[model samples]
Target: MMRRHPSHLRLKPLAKQVIVITGATSGIGLSTARAAAARGAALVLAARNEDALKAVAEDLSSKGAEVAFVAADVGREADVRAIAAVAVSRFGGFDTWVNNAGVTIVGPAEQTSLDDQRRLFDTNYWGVVYGSLAAIDQFQNQAGGGALINVGAGDVALPLQAAFFASKHAVKGFTDALRTELMAAHAPVSVTLIKPSGADTPGKDNARNLTGAPIAHPAGIYATPLVAQAILYAAEHRTRELTVGSGGRLLALASQVAPALTDPLLAIGARLNARIAKAPDPARIDNLHHAGRDLRERSFQPGVRETSLYATAQMKPKTTLGLMAAAALAAGFAFKLGARKAAPIDE
Candidate 1:
């Protein structure tokens, strides 16, 4: 549970903020770098790929955005600390840190190797833990507090990617607990979790595919810019959690209200989606062991529609919550009506 803070809290302007982002070479992290830089924020980009980091830094620099790069793996605590160290060295103290580095293993829980599962948690869960701790420490030492944002997936258990979903849930749980602790301590730092639904990114090819099937992000895929928008918003303002897309939002609600129904539905979807009979070469296809350097903007998959549900929901929380509740009520009422029509008439 994210604790809401007073609206009067002061935050530094985007132009003056020194932001550090992990997994900055590609996907949401890369998009976030571009967005934040355009806002005049100084950026420190970190990833395991040195060449890709240089390319991103050069591109941002050419566009006159203050930027630096650190080639480090988020899975290592020392490397994560080095990212903060670079921010201080280049831009003199970081104001916002986005822990966006994560990986996935596409396969059933039984089929996915234990080593692979542990690796997923190391990057998804432990990476956030390490980055948050570093950012909080820096915020405590500084005069003004800062924002710590963790880019997490929707908080729902899905099929085929059991470990990946579990890792995401762990991230949410850890983030909530950290928020509670920070509030109790009266710390000025703000922690936020940004959960984006399926987006068309290289993540499909970037992950370890143990299922021996072609894997891709779920339907209703939105572009990465939408997620970057939410990330930038949370950086300048205080946000508890932001879920980005109607598809993800609906799935989360379904999982919460009807897990029995959603469980099998999700399983069936995953099984059917994994029907592509080709397998990716583990050594060349996966970035689980090392950093991947194929950095690009979008995956460009066909037949998927985009949405702005997340951005709208972020801008209007009360309206969004009310609409979601109204939808639930409408669904219940329709079910009752159908039941009445099916029942034997009293004659």
Candidate 2:
């Protein structure tokens, strides 16, 4: 069993807190930055692109937000430390640090080169490690401690993106272990692992696609803001983990309940993913080796869900569960009545 802290923890409100977010130039990171700023939070943003970071800082600053940015890659320890240094220099210190910087490779695990796999780990896994340590050190010395939020994917592994899935699994392990250590020591920090489902972010477009075809998320995709909301909620509240969409929660459940059935379904989904691509881009550029240039948050995918009832349930479990159970019972009763009516009269 995991140990619990002896003391009560208190986190600051968004308007009065200083938040540091890595990978702030685009996607969920950018969306989180925007939402935090809107809530009157002072922001410290980090990303590989200096120009894009500057542009984001300026835009947020124009709206009367106290925003600072550092151009640092989280994969490097020194660079990750620099992000903390700027946060201290600009706003005294940060209340929440989000390790959201990551890159993906869309191809078979065997076909992926050893060098490419290492590079992906450098950004995805090592990046989270470095940021988590940095945030822990700062929080340990501070009065209120802090929130450490790591953006991870759904727990289930996908067929085409093995490397990415492996990295996420590593992140989940690290985050959980760190949370346990913090609790044992009676630390005030709140560590949260955010497992989002297929989000309509630019990640697919930014991925290193070696399959010679356009790639897309194989499952239901939710809007970036849904994930941003979860991140921000973790910033203010203490939660062990939060899944952003119902699809992610369902996949996790299925994987545990029926792995034998789930494996074949995932394989079918992988093949369907390739077929669903409208066309392949001949000049597509991936950010696996370099800084991403695009700053757009949304992928503009059709059928993007704007909200998630499952996500709401994660934040408020008892009430949502009660509502969901009642709805399920009603549906089951209706189905039973319909089946009885359709029975043969001779019976």
Candidate 3:
């Protein structure tokens, strides 16, 4: 039902407008890439995974989407610069660049490693910094207006994942200031910030770099298709700021209404999660593909099919009531299943 937006949307004037995506090897990056590709955008995928990048490119190419990729780690300035270069070389220049490369660090602050803290800044925060600078310079060079979108998480904050939260918070602040600076100077290129909840991503397993805390909540059988869709829509519309997930919106609300109350509560959650939450240890986690224990085991509905990220965004006045009813039934059914599983073990 989502018709193509017209050639103007696709071409965006001049030659094919390139789309640059960091952390394009997996998770929301990969999914978002697919969405953009479907919309007829040429892609310049950036990631540390050369083989994976090739595979994605080939797969998408087979489907008739023009794609190219670079093996660059956004954590490093040089690597990020190279990534931008690849995009310019391959497609001339990008119309949109997505800063999505990031890592998660979970656990208590006391136990978190300095190495992880550094990496968190490197990938989660500095990655955005490096990517932004790279994109801005390219936009300036091309003398063309483009966009920079930084993929974010949760709300403005989350106590348990202090390091992770800090990284995102840093991004949010940096982006807000950058947005204002650009506007003040009247730069044609735009900046956007995408705040999504813990999505259904392989990043959950790879993010186990922290032995102390967790980087994110595990994804279950049901994924946040709507959130993913929101990112794509935001990209199309060139929206400045976006928040995904009901929980994410609620967290924003909580932060505003009662910071004092939320702060202590978050601190308590952080403390408890440090000892509990028995997720993967830093050593056990890998950046490569690894799906952790199924979050769906607790809440999966047998007959319900997953809603695609694209579908998730389509639920408006037209689709809201149906979604809510289905969600309510799903919650109750999931509880019933959980109780049944627990009762036998208790016996």
Q: Give the whole-model CA lDDT for all candidates, comma-separated.
A: 0.84, 0.90, 0.68
Clash list (residue pairs), candidate 3? 106-213, 106-214, 107-212, 107-213, 107-214, 220-296, 221-296, 225-309, 226-312
- lDDT-based ranking, best first? 2, 1, 3
| lDDT tens digits by residue: candidate 3, 267-341 | 776556545334554455365223222211112223222554423544343477777889999999999999998
The top-ranked prediction according to TM-score is 2
Q: Model 3, stretches more than 4 Å misplaced?
A: 1-16, 209-225, 259-284, 288-347
lDDT at 161 for candidate 2? 89
- How well is each residue in 1-347 modelled by candidate 2, as lDDT tens digits? 22235257778999999999999998999999999999999999999999999999999999999999999988899999999999999888999999999999998888999999999999999999999999988988877888999999998988888999999999999999999989888877899999999888888888899887778655478999999999999999998999999998888899999999999998988878777764645676788989999798987867889999889988988898899899999999999999999998985
Query: Least accurate stretch of 10 residues (summed lDDT) in model 2?
Result: 1-10
Error of 3 at 285 (Å): 3.9
User: In candidate 1, what are the lDDT values of residues 1-347, reduced to their tens digit?
Assistant: 22233343467888989999998988899999999999999999999899999999999999999898999888889999999898888777998999998887887789888888888888989999999999988887776778999988876767777898899889899999998898877777888999888766677778887766677556678888888988888988888988888778888888889989998887678767855333444556588888886686567667455668667778678999999999999999999999999999788
Question: Over the full model, what C-alpha lDDT does candidate 1 score relative to the true structure?
Answer: 0.84
Top-scoring candidate (lDDT): 2
Which 10-residue window in model 1 sums to the lowest lDDT? 1-10
